[model samples]
Target: MVETDKPKQHRSRVLEGMAHAVSQKGYGDTTIADIVREASVSRRTFYEHFSSKAECLVALYEAASHNSLKVLRDAIDPAHEWQTQVERALAAYLGSMQANPVLVRTLFIEILHLGPEGLAARRRVNSVVADFILSMVNGSKGPKSHVLSSGMATAIVGGINELVLEYIEQDKVKYLDELVQPASDLVHAITRT
Candidate 1:
């Protein structure tokens, strides 16, 4: 059991290191050495976990995305109406991003630099988020709810990503909360149709 936990712990540490290194140096400039150093692990340890720096960054992005989704999930108020629940989730999600500008820059902006691999990882994360949105919308108990098809759910995620990217590129990730209203409204409009 201890042996099993060691690899998992080392892998998680490397992912955390990748986030820290990329946040400090940008993904393009970050090196494996920097990652291991940030992780307080050796080069051999990083190699044990990831084949390359880009791979490590992708791993970190996926982990961060899941964590952010958890924040959204935990913000939900089941007793409230679905729309109110949606707004609350969005508020929590954006609020978490606003509090972690460096994380936003590393995961959001830096991931785009890795060509096909980065895009693939991003697509996977987006699909997961879309599925979560589908659950939230379709699982609600009311009319005009669950009308969301998977395609439409994915589209909504993409549209909101574009909105957030606009802010990220402008070094305004701290203002992510500004998107809560627009994002919730877009969901409302699309679901109503």
Candidate 2:
């Protein structure tokens, strides 16, 4: 049992190191050597953790989602208007991305090439955001209270994700406040209690 657990722990460490390296060097440029070096582990150790770079990326996506979800949860306020809630969530996400631009680029753009795992991670984040929005519209009762389609919720979150990416990549926020109103409006317009 101990030996089995060791591999799992090492895998997490390797994934974390890869995320850090990719954040700095980008996924395309990052190599296995860089990941193992970042983890301070030997080549054999890395192989024990993952079969290849793609597997490492799968783990990285999970890590990034966990971090992003924490930030989003903190931004939520039960007392705030649904509009304000959306704004706060967007602000929180964008702020996090701005603070960790390299990580954002790796998770959002680079790691996508890793196939199913990467795509699933992205979808998981989107679902989280949709659920958050649904909560605001439905209150504690959940989807039963809000009549919005799942498709609409997905679209709104996707748009928000794209917008956040643009804001991060361009290194400019010409009118940051505008993002809030539109984001809130989009959610409010679609959601009916």
Candidate 3:
């Protein structure tokens, strides 16, 4: 069992280290040595988990996205009205992001400097978020074809992301929850049609 668990533990440490390194030095200046030092692990251990800085950043992004998605999934209550559900989910998402400002900055801002690999990871994360929005929209009652299509869901995700990015850029990540109402309004406007 110890043998089986070691890899998972090492991976977690590496991810934590990546978040710290990127948050401190930004992705452009972070190196494998920095990650290992931040993680308190050997260089070999870092390489055991990730091939490169970009790869490590991707892993960190994926892990963080997975965790945030869980918070969102748990926040959703099917019994509530659709608009209420959207508000709850949005609040939960923004709250999670606010609670982890460093991770959010690293994931959203620093990761972008990783070039194509970063772009690909970002696209994948956006697609996953869009899928969640699509599920929520599909579960709610709305006009058959007036709005709330997969494309619309993707667009909504983009808008929400932009809003969060604005907050991050302005160093107002704590105000992210303030966006819940506007975000919900945007989603509700389309779905209510």
Candidate 4:
């Protein structure tokens, strides 16, 4: 591999190893050895990129969150009706989650058990999502009387997270797209009022 590609390859392997390790053993029970073994790398190689498993998990979560946000952003269309945009965004968000159930499960479930740092990461991701929703709502509101507030945007993000969590807990992740209509409707009601 090229010199620069080495770090990227190692990081990708570590993240993939994290997903596999967590999926097999649960994040709480997985160890550095398990991750290294899963990645087919030495312990020293793992440490070169991450100080600890928690840090690795945070990196995994951040990468996934960034990719998901890109999907949501790309799905938006200025020419579309606001409600349609909402539906499309929600669908794209859920679709990305559905495409990566292992990572999604680790993110929405396992990462929560990582304590304060994990919570902070989760909140940071949620804030990004909320900001995206807020921007979409603001852009589409135009001169409409009803407008969504920042607090409302946060609540909406929380609500959508809850909905996704429920589906994940039920082992129905494939049905995530089913949430698009309800989520869009919720946004519609909140934005119209």
lDDT of 1 by residue, 1-193 (tens): 6888999999999988888888888888899989999989999999988888888888888888988999988898766666767778899999998887767886678998999999999999999999988887888766663378999999999888888999988878888999999998888888883
Count of backbone collisions in candidate 2: 0
Model 1 alpha-carbon drift over 4 Å, by segment? 1-4
Q: Pick the candidate with the highest lDDT.
A: 4
lDDT per model, in order? 0.86, 0.72, 0.84, 0.87
**Order the candidates by TM-score, highest first — what do you get?**
4, 3, 1, 2
Task: In candidate 3, list every pair of residues with a backbone clash.
Answer: none
Evaluate residue 127 in candidate 4 and report its C-alpha lDDT on the 0 to 100 scale: 94
lDDT of 1: 0.86
Please give the TM-score that candidate 1 achieves against the real structure.
0.90
Which of candidates 1 and 2 reaches a greater TM-score? 1
Candidate 4: misplaced stretches above 4 Å?
A: 141-143
lDDT tens per residue, model 2, 1-193: 6887877778778877897888778787889999999887888999876788887787777677678778877887765655446667877766676666556667668768766877877787778777765555656433344466668878888877677667656754444445666666666666642
Query: What is the alpha-carbon lDDT of model 4 when measured against the actual structure?
Result: 0.87
lDDT string for model 4 (1-193, tens) is: 6898998899899999999999889999999999999998889889999999999999999998899999989998877655657777789889999988888888899889889999999999989988988777777734565667888999888888888999989999989999998888777777773
Model 3: C-alpha RMSD to truth? Answer: 1.8
Minimal lDDT window, size 10, model 1: 138-147
